[model samples]
Every structure is written in structure tokens, then in C-alpha cells.
Target: MILLLLILTLLSLSRGRPNSSIVNHSTQLLRRLGVKRVPFQFDPYKEGLYYTNLDQNLRQVILNARNWTQISTLSNIDFIRAHNVELGRMQQTIPASSRFPCNLSQTRSPDVASHISRLRPGDIDIVAAFGDSTIAGTGIMALGFWDLMVEYRGFAYTGDGIESWRTVLTLPNILKLYNPNLYGYAVAHSLSADVKRSRLNVAEPMLYLLDLPFQVHVLIDRLHKDPKVNIHVGPNDICSELCYWHDLEAFLRLEERQLYASFRLLRDNVPRLLINFIIQPDIDDVMNVFSEMPDDCTTKASFFCNCHGKYKQEKYYNVAKRFFDMQKSIASLPELQRDDFAIVTHEIFKNVSNLWSRNGALDKRFMANDCIHYSQLAHAVLAKLLWNNMLNQTDFTLSEARRRPFEYFLCPNADRQFLRTTGDRF
Candidate 1:
């Protein structure tokens, strides 16, 4: 009776002809069980279409399958072994020698820059970040679906200060090689943002463009209370992700007004600050990468940009482009470019699609299990890109950055001193 029920379920689920060997085996089993014929006729054309959709749904189910009790009861050793495997995989692509070189005996500038424009990499004392999950370091070290929820803040590309650039290449880690006393970067995994470990990385997961102002306020408040912080000569390194979502012009206009007001607040409260505004990649390019991913991965990624469909993608792309242009315009505003404060827009990720493909197939190694967030290797590469962009290196491109046997960008002879630049001015 149980076998009969199981066979009936399989037949109902696959209403089309059995083309695969597994399906043929099932048909043979049904015959041995005294089942005369299938309840419905099979259509060859529909079989192809039906199985395609069924395969996708089954993949999603399999991807999401996890033993919750086992995951909850996992030992520290289990996690360590998993992380080791992941680290080993990443090292296979990016070796330890490719990590940014560190100079432990390096010294800070004798005279810290009183003006933001004159600040060097070693001059930065405080590092803070805001925006979305990318800045917060979501899923950078994830090995599975369960791990994807864990925010490995220390692995973030922007303001992470982990062991060293060798273990995890991040902007803050690279800067630490110059300034050992650099403060405010998240050190380890944090289940929530309202924890002591979260530090100055106030970025939240799944946050929209409009939520940036709130994050700015939170960061400002934290900075004021921290006793170790001295805002006078201590230049703050602020990294922010400003990606677009809404299509309405009014929405963009409102965001601009709020962001401008937030900048004004920062300028009024915090002096000697260098804000790095990271512009996201093109929406069409992101969608193209999604299209190349497995069906389950694409379905998961769609939630991030559900507003963008086959017909509406162009509109979203235009809006995102406009938002990026707005950021550039805002950065160039004379009123905002004071000696004490400066906002520099980094367009390194504007064409990130170059890194998503290799040999005409989606590079799964560069993406997390969810296929939404970047993998650790991807973060390491982006760190190099950001560093190169800040140094105003024109030769380094995204395509070259993602190449195998990864190579760190060499500092130009004239700019080898780790001095910071707006990339637009000296």
C-alpha cells in the first residue's frame, strides 16, 4: 500500500513522459507493483518544460535543507574545521603571498594632517562604516545556508580589521599596517548590531538607500561617547555603500536632501574626516550575473531586486546610474569639500560584472551560498581594487583584479608612502 501511494505521488508530480533513466526505473517499478498504466497521458514538449521547473524547485529545496538541531548543537571544532576548509579553498585561488604586504615597524606620520585633504593612510585614527550588508560583511565566510546569516564583520572589505591582510584583506586591515592603533573596526562575528563587538560598523543587512541617514546618526552618536576617540587631529575613515532601489524621482530627491543634511551634520560635528562613498555595480550587470547562476540561486537573489524584471530592468538601471551620478555631484559640491572634511566617490565596483564571469560560466567561487553576497575571495579582490582606486592607479582594472594567481597592486614610486588621495585632487 505504501509503495502504491509513493508511485502515485511520483506520477502525479511528473505529468509528462519519463525521459530520464531514473524515471524509467520508476515506471518499471510501477509495473512490477501491478500498476497497469499512468493516470494521465504524457506530452513530449511539456515534459521538457515541466521537468525544467521541477528541477529548479527541487534544487531550491535541497539547497535549503538543513538539520536545525545539528547546526544549533555544532561544536567549536566543527565550525573551525568548516572554516579551515573554506579558507583552504580561498587560498587555492589567492595564496598568502598575494596578500597585501605588511610593515610592522612602519611608523605614522610625524605630524598628523590637520586637514582632511592632507591626510595619509597612516593618519587615519578611527574607521567607521554605514549602508548595507556589503559594508557590514554579511556571509563573507559562509560555508552553507546556515552560515549565511552569520555576520562576519571582521571579513568586510571596507572597514574590517581582522588578523592581517594575509588572513583577510580589508581596507582597515591594510591601514593597520601603517597605523597600529587604528580603532572602531568590528573584530569578530556579531549576531546583532546592538552588541559591544559590532564596534563602529553600524551597517545593517537588507537596508535600503533611505536608511543611510539613520546609520550616520548612530555612528556620530557612538563617536561622541567613545573616550579613546579624539576628533581633532584623528582623521576618521568612513566607508559607505549607497545603492539605489526606488524608481521615483521624488524618492531620489528626498534621499539626496537627507544625505546632504546628514553630511552637513557630520561636517558640523566631526572634523578631519575622509568619507569613501562606494558606488554599487550596474543593475543590469548584476542581473546578468544572477541569470547565469543556478536556478535556486537566481530565485534567492531576486528578492534583493524584485522590482527589476525583464521589462522594468532598464528603468531600474537608469535610476541606479542617476543615483551614482548624484553621488559624484554631491562629492564635488564646493560647500562639502572643506579642508576638514571630504567625500570621495569610489567607482571601482561600477563595472563588477567583469569579475563575475570566467570561461563563459558564472564563477560560483566568487559568490556566497545564497548567491547574493560576495565570498571571501571576492572581498579580498575588492579590497585591492579599493586600495588601488584610492591611490589613483589608472592601470589596474576589475578584469585584471579577478585574474587567477592573484597579484597585489604595487604602489607607484611617487605614491609609495601610503598617502591618501581623493583620486580627483592631490
Candidate 2:
């Protein structure tokens, strides 16, 4: 059975298209293997049962070269209905009475920051993101296995501009409320990163930490060539698993050198830039949630982190801690901190696994259909957390934060006065 699964993975990696027979056979094998089905309560639109092997299903479908054809036939109405259902769920979670309206009249600071350190959320002109499939938004909206190949880029927490914060609630969308003319966010979904529609979201699915410099290069090239307005590029890299951690120091050193070089190039060329380095959730923390799941679904952790299943608990914990420390060390590099460019690291996701589970049962809605990436709802929550972090507000424990209504993070009455008085700085 393991050999057959390996064969399927290799076949999916091949460039040649697999026939329908192969796809059907793979699907049957997956079902026979008793893939666990996660329960979701709010499926008003009646999307199929969510499965742990959705990513595997997606791989098979992509190998068949039929993802686009299938998506093309899917109606825009389907997207709309799915969106509406999400909105309905959000409304239930966060009632309107709990929300406080922001004074849109007083948006940006009176003057732009001479140094990136003082840059406010309202001052950002362009929004960008880099990382792996999580940042690429692979399978964010997949209702079933077949829908997994779609890159719902616009719903990504780092750089999405599908609609307003009222609906989609992404970081870019929230920033748009402050700067209406904010450019460079992925406006809608795209099949691939190379497409023009991907815009400033240069993230690619399955990219490793080593691949970040290349993505930085692509983003820089795009900024230089595009005739769009110049100045102020706020690029966020939502980093995930660093690597296998076979040689942790070596991996960190290589990544640091490459990333420093890339940032230095951007700083020298670009006038005003803010680089946000969001620390990913601890792998052990995330894997713990899966560990509690049925045996069939527990293997999903291996898909995201190769070391999780193989390593001892003590070794995994030590490696994970060292990885996070290295990330902070890289962020603190004196050379990378400049007047025009600054790197800010957010540590909110360090304990995010606590947010997804309550009393030992996982909340399936916060996760994507693949059971790997975040769902649209989770992306919205992340956007709020990132925004709160930017404001220098008290960091809410993910579990505590989940209990509060979304509006709790929005415009507070106390903030309104501060926002009104301090139009010059935030």
C-alpha cells in the first residue's frame, strides 16, 4: 500500500498527462484506504464532505492536466455562493452590533514616514507576499478534492484583494480600507504564478525557504518593469517549515545570506519599503492537532513537515525552537535595517495550533479542504492578527482571540480618539 502511494506521488510529479483511468484508479485506492472525513457544520451550499487526502486528489487531477478545464466549467455563481456562505458564517461568528466603524475620513498619516520604521498601515501604497503554498493560497476554497488545484490567491492572508475587508477580510483588503488606491495585490484567483493576474503575489506553491530569494528577484523585476506608481512596497513573507533541519545551522546560514542579499538589493533600489517577516506556527504545535485526529488523517502532517513523523518528540521540539531563534536572528541583522527599509517579525503564529482545537476536537472550518493550508475564515483571522500586531496592540492568545468576535479587533472607541488626534503618526 505504501509502495502504491509512492508510485502515485511519482506519477503525479511527471510532466506527461495521466489518463482518466489512472485518476479513477487513484481515487478508488484513496477511498479504500479509508481516508478520514472532517466534519463541517456550515455547508449551506452543500459542498461535498471534506477529506484529509484532498491534496492527493488535487495532485492526481493536476497530473491529468484537466484542472483548468474543470474550473472553467464551474460557474461564477458557484464562487459567489461559496463566498456568501462564508460571509454568513462570519456574520454568525461576529455580529454587526459588536463591530465599530472606522473613521475613513482620517485614513493616512498627514505625511509619509521618512524612515520605514515609522510607516503606518495607512501609508502603505503597494502590498506583496512571498512564501510557499500557504502564501500562494493553494486549495483555500476547495469544497472537495477536485477543487484543490485552484490557487485562490485573492483569499490569501498575506496578499489578497478579492473584495473589501467587509467580505473577504484579507490583509491587502484591510489595507485597502486605509489606502483605497493600494496596488500590487492579487485581485482574483489564478491558475499559476506566471499569469499577469497574480500581480505582486509572487508566492509559488510547494516552494522551499531556499526558493525565497528567487521569488524576491521576480518581485523586484516586476516592480522595475511595471509602469505603476513608484515608492512604498510592503512585501510580506509568511514563512512556513524552514527545511528538513538535517543541518539546521547550515540551512539557516544559507537562507540568511540569500535573503540579506535580496533585501539589500531591494533597499538600494526602492525608496520606501516595509518587509514583514511573519514567523510560521511551530511544526510540533501544528502536528499536535493532527496527532489527535484519527490514524488515517494523522499522516497528513508528513505532507507538510517531513521530519515530524520520523523524529523523536524531544528532537523535534529542540529543532523547532532553534529554527524560530534563527528566524529572529535573521530579522535582527543590523545591516538589513535601514531608514528606507525595515524588517518586522510577527510571533503571533507561534502558538496557533491552540486556536484550531477546543476540548480535543478540531474546528474543521479554520482549516482548508486539503487539511494542510488555512481556510478563507482562517485567513481573515490571520489578517486581523497581523493588523493588531502592526498597531502594537497586546497579542491575543489564538485560543482567546478565537473566542472574541472579529469586531473586537476593529476600531475601538479609545482608538478613534487617538486616530483622530495622531494623523501624523500611528
Candidate 3:
């Protein structure tokens, strides 16, 4: 009987179906662990964690791919709904106002979800979002706000879990095998030496300054190569506040020179694509804590009081205005109006600010243990925003309320399914 089973297994392996071959091979994996029987039925989306091989296989679907196109129009989503706890305020740690503490968790509002739901997927089916922690869904781990909306779009989810800086190739051609729906997704991240800057905070403004044009070029090029790709670029890359408070005299010089080179390349290579430009509201006022300190030579005195006290939020709002202006300038580039590119205004930071103000109460988990990184709630907001920003179609409509199913998110309890390390490397 064992010999007969071997012959049958060999026969099954010869078939062209990848799953059949996979399951047969998986049966061997089970046998090694003293589990004899294997079910023929498997749902990757729901059961992915159980079989490490399957999870590994799915991970491969995103990392390595080329010559791919994906389609889906409207995204229906489930946000990981959970109760939140409000705990320590940033003021205790930063010695600043309890009101303003680089708090993104407070800024994750869902009204944008409604706007997103109102969009239409049109002809595009796939999306590629590439950038820093904002795109990585930092605060809301289970499902970033973007993921929620993308789900509604009827496309696959491919963004990485955290700040996948400059790794534009996260989901390469190989990912297409399982996600026949795959078009492509790109991620580009730049840090101010890692933790110094948050989207709510501006880190190394110079790195972004120089890399922007080049990254923009890559986005355009990819869009051209694959028109099916609805590309969202620039939000996680630029912060209007940096220039507001920071004297760009030195960095500006570098950017001015590098930007021209990069722009030239982008202009020459970037294809027209449906676009969304990410912008922050009140960046100069709120984020550029240094915008008004006399460029001459000032200590933390003048702005410090204003930052934590009364004028505190005024600058943020004002700086946000300037940031919006810059967004407009960037979008107005002659290329934006071209027949090929469709620019979508992603008033991202404004939405964030709204969330911050209306965040009912704080969820202790919303703040990271380090007082910098966000907790799960934060990532959920990010995923929500991403979902909103990406699906720019006229027909699709999104929900802004926190009405998502808990089960949909890949939660911590799912860790039981973590794959055993294999000796192999991809």
C-alpha cells in the first residue's frame, strides 16, 4: 500500500497544477512531523500562516516579479476594529505641550474612507505604493488604512509591514505567479538616519530633497511601462515643514543641483500615469517647529514656548498651508497636465490633522512603548489613508467610520502560524 501511495504521489506530481504539486509536497512535510493525512483543500488568504511553505510561496509572489499587470476596480475592506487605551502623553517625555507630540495615532481619522468609497476604479486594476513608515502602515499594523481601501479596489495587497526604504523592488515579477492579479507595487523610503523623522515629523529633509526627482522619475517610468498601474507617489517623500523651519540654504543648494539632474532624468523617462500627490496640512505651523526661529541665530527659546503653549498649533496650521502650496507647485509641473498622467490630490496630512483632533480619546496602545513609533491603532489609520489615496476612481466610495471587521486583519494571535525556518534562501 505504501508503494502504491508512492506511485500515486509521483503521478500527482506530474500534473501541471501548481497547487496539486504543492499539496503533494506538503503532505511529505506533514509526514515528517508525524502527521499522516493532508487535506486537499486550502485557502491561502485565510490559512496562509499554517504552512510555512505556503506563506513563503506567497511572500515570493510580491518580492520577485516583472512583465506583470493586475486589475480590480472597487476595494471593499475590513479595518481591524479594537478598543484603544489612552496612556502617557508626549509632553511627559518631550517636555512639550500635551496637545502636540508628533502624534500620528491621534491623527488617524476615517472620513477619508468615505471619500475613497466615492471613487471609481475606472480602467486600472493594480496599484504600487512605495515609501516610508507612512506607507508601511506604521501605527496600524494589522491593516494600514491604505490596505483597507485597496481591498475595496478588488486588487491584491503588497505593501511591506514597516519602513521599507528605497526597496522599490519589494514585489518583483515572481509575485505574479499566485496573484495573477498583480500589476506591480513599489516602495521607496528615506530616513533621517532611521528614527529622527516621522511623516508627522521631518527627518533628513536633504535625503528626500535629492532623491525626490529620481524617485518621481522611477514612478513615471513604471507607470508608462505598465499603464494598468495606478501610481501614488510623493506623500511619504516630501514634508513642507522642513523648508518652513529649516534654512534650506545649504541643503537647498544640494537639492537645487541634484533635483535638476534627477528631474531631467524623470522628465525624459517618466510616463504619464494616474497620480496622487501627498500633502500635509499645517506642516509649517505644526511640523516645522523651527520655521519661525530667526534664521539669524536663535536658540530653542522663541519657538519652544510657541510650540508647546498658545502659538503652538498656529504654526503647524500655517506651515501646513505652505506645504499645500508646494504640493500645488509640484503637481502643476507641465508633466502633470499631460494626456498620460492623472494627478490626484491626496490631502493626506489635512486628513491626518482631522483624525488627530477627533480621536475620541487616546488609546494607550496607540502610542509606541518608545514614545516614537505608533502602536497597532496607528498603522490601521495609515492603512486607511493609503486605501483612500490610492483608489482615485470616480465610481468607488469608501467609509470613513471605524467600521471594519476584526477577523480580516492578520493579528498577533496569528503568530502561531509562523513558518519554521527552512534551510533554503530565496
Candidate 4:
């Protein structure tokens, strides 16, 4: 009877096709080993179509037009606009809740020790700065922004504490750097870029960057502690200029889903797990610093120009605006709208970049040789801005006098040394 059943199963699998012999033999072999063939369907739902039921006239509307001005016309499509409007009306009807109480008077005081000591078992306070080289501090990791944030408690001299990538460190991991047990996490890389290649700096491919298994491997190495992750990178997404706007929009939507899944996994494993994201600096504003530099096109063979070349400043501006819009859309996502999931805005960095542009200080002095990364002075200013933003978001205030640029640097000597060493050479 068992032999007969095996023969019947083999015949069913074969269907007498050209490759029936191979199929029948494989099925019979599996049956002999008691391996049942279980058939399953892998079907995924498709994303809802936006203008599926629209009339021909409305269907002709190009919702996602290339230029910002064209996008405003009635011909442009807005799939989410309806949803956003509905949400806005609902918000008006609901009572406002203050998850973050503005405690302007409560500054970072002598009670720092108590704050550091307040961590109970299973309590997690992670500051995972995820982004491109800016968050990584690239070559500045040893003497860069992270060190500066940790060095200044009262503005004297303090040594650098734990490295940012250490997974298993102590708790009370707020802004303080001296806590030997405290942990820090970095999910950033200097060359971390956007989804396509279109005349932008191409170091790593976007598909690889977004690959689940690969990201799990990279992130797990540093983020295994299940800490609250903070992402501060996005400008690189549009660094290619005038390329991949659709790609950027799609990437963010997919990323929102991935982040929600990743955060859920962490939340299940860690206590009070949170995720924060900082909007990137306006690339157009920063690019203006490079744009105004004198063009040095000596020859037609000169393929590259260091801020001194004929480049479309408006293209960079448009891309930056679109990038900011994409970020705002992602932040407004329901999954990322939780109290634990916060978004630090772009106003502070935007202001600083604008200051540099207006003062004609966007020269080589403020940036590295590549004219991309920040100089030591620039880093100091940018770090203080970030520090202040964090302080405000957490409802921790500082007396205006305490917020000096020099106070943030842990070792100004080391920073200067690193800058000098990498100056015009990097």
C-alpha cells in the first residue's frame, strides 16, 4: 500500500511532461525519505492605486511633476493630500496633549550624578546617531562632534569616554560622556547615499544600503543592545541633483515600513525603546557655499571641480526642497508619530548654513578639502546646534550663557590636530 501511494504521488507530480522523469524521481525519492511536499502560495498585496477611479481629465493630471511650480498646478496629483486633510480636521477636534513639557528653568545642573544614577534594571536610554559621514564624524570620530558633546560638562577639559560603536556599555546614556558604563551607537557612514546614480558621488549602491539582511547584519553589530535609534542622514539621498525624486519618495515609504518593523522588534526586546530622526541640513543652502566659489575650468578635460566649476545652483536648490518635503512626509507617518518616536526639525542647521552663506564664510576654511565635510570650526558650531536641539526636545534647558561653542569641545587640541592632519589632504 505504501509503495502504491508513493507511485501515485510520483505520477501526480510528473504529469507526463518532458521533464517528467526528473520530477517523478525527485518526488519518489522524497516520499521514500518521508518528506511530504507542502505547497504554499507567496502572495503580497499591491499598494493601492491613487487615481484609479478618476475621470480622463483628472487622470491626465501629473501629480508628481518634475518641478515644484508644476506640482502646484491642478494637473498635479496628491494621493495623500486627502488623508492629510482628514487627519488635520480630526486633530482640531481632539484635545491637545503635551508629551514634552517645556521646563525652561530646569537646566543641566549639579544633579547630573543623580540623572546618571537613575537607571533601573531594564531601563534603556540609547542615542543612536544614524546617518552619513556627518553623524559618523568620519575621520573626526576620535576628535569630532561626538567627543565635543561629551567633553563639556562645565566647560573645562575632560577626556573622551566610550566610543560610539560600543554595543555593551553602561546605562544613563543621556548626553554626558564621563559615565564609563554608558553606551553609544552609530549607524552612520560617510558615503551613505541615496537610491540611484545620476552624476552624484557614488560610493555605495542604494539597493545594498536598503537590503534587509545586510542592514540587519550591520545594525545588529552596533545596535544589538536594542537602544533607541536616532537617524540624522538624508541629504545624500538627493546629492545626485535633479535625479531620482520618484526613487526618493518610494525609498522613504519603504523605509518607513522597515523602520517600523525594526523598532517593533527592538521594543519587544528592550524597555522604553524609542526612535528619533533629525531632518538633514538644506543641501541647496550648503551647496550655495560651493556654488559661489570661483570656477576653475582650465581645460575641457577637467571633469572635476572643487566648488570652482560651472554647476547648476538651482538644481541643487530644487532637490534640497524636495528632499525636505520627503522627510516631512515620512515624519508625519502614523508609525513614526508616537511620543517615543520624535523628529528634530531642520531650522537650526538651516539657520547656521544660511549664516555661513550670507557671511561669505562658505570658503575652504569652513569645510574640508572635498568642500563637503565640515571643518573643525564648522563642526563645533554644528555640534552646539545639535546639542541645543536635543536639550530643547528633551525639555532640558540650559542658561543662555552655558551654551558657548568652545564649551562643547572635549579636547580642542585634538580637534585642531585632526583638522590640520586632514586639511586639504582628505
Predicted model with the maximum lDDT: 2
Residue range 1-426, candidate 1, lDDT tens digits: 000000000010121222244334434443443434422335432210012334433432332232221234233535743674555424343355554443434335578666655556667777877766777666666666666665666777776676677667777777777677778777765422333566777666655444444555566666776776665100000112222323246656855675576667677777667777665555556556656777777776766545445425565457655765665676568888776677766666554556766765667777766677777777777777777666665343547544432465645333465444454542
TM-score of each: 0.72, 0.72, 0.39, 0.43
Can you rank all candidates by lDDT, best first? 2, 1, 4, 3
- Model 1: how far residue 316 lies from native, Å: 3.9
Clashes of 2: 0
List candidate 2 segments past 4 Å from native. Answer: 1-70, 73-100, 192-195, 231-249, 294-296, 313-317, 403-405, 410-426
lDDT of 3 by residue, 308-381 (tens): 23234554444434444654555456643443433444443443323332233223343333222344444444
For all candidates in order, the CA lDDT equals: 0.55, 0.56, 0.30, 0.30
Report the CA-based lDDT of candidate 1 relative to the real structure. Answer: 0.55
Kindly give the stretch of ten consecutive residues in candidate 1 with the minimal lDDT sum: 1-10
For residues 159-216, write the lDDT of model 2, one tens digit per residue: 7688666667777777777677888787767643333566777776666554454555
Q: Can you list the residue pairs that collide in candidate 4?
A: 63-76, 63-77, 133-190, 170-181
Using TM-score, give the best candidate's number.
2
Between 1 and 2, whose lDDT is larger? 2
Pick by lDDT: 1 or 4, better one? 1
Assess the local accuracy of residue 15 in candidate 1 as a C-alpha lDDT between 0 and 100.
16
What ranges in model 4 sit over 4 Å off? 1-125, 139-174, 177-180, 185-217, 225-232, 241-271, 294-320, 337-347, 393-404, 407-426
> Can you list the residue pairs that collide in candidate 1?
none
How well is each residue in 1-426 modelled by candidate 4, as lDDT tens digits?
A: 000000000011111112334224434433543434432335332221111222222312321111122212213223322332333210111123421112222222333223222222123223333333443333221122222111111110111113221211111212333222333322112122111100011111112112222232233333332343322143444443224334445655554454344334333433333333445555555455554544431221122222222235555445446655655465445553332332323344454344444344444344433344443334444444443433333111332222233333222121221111101121
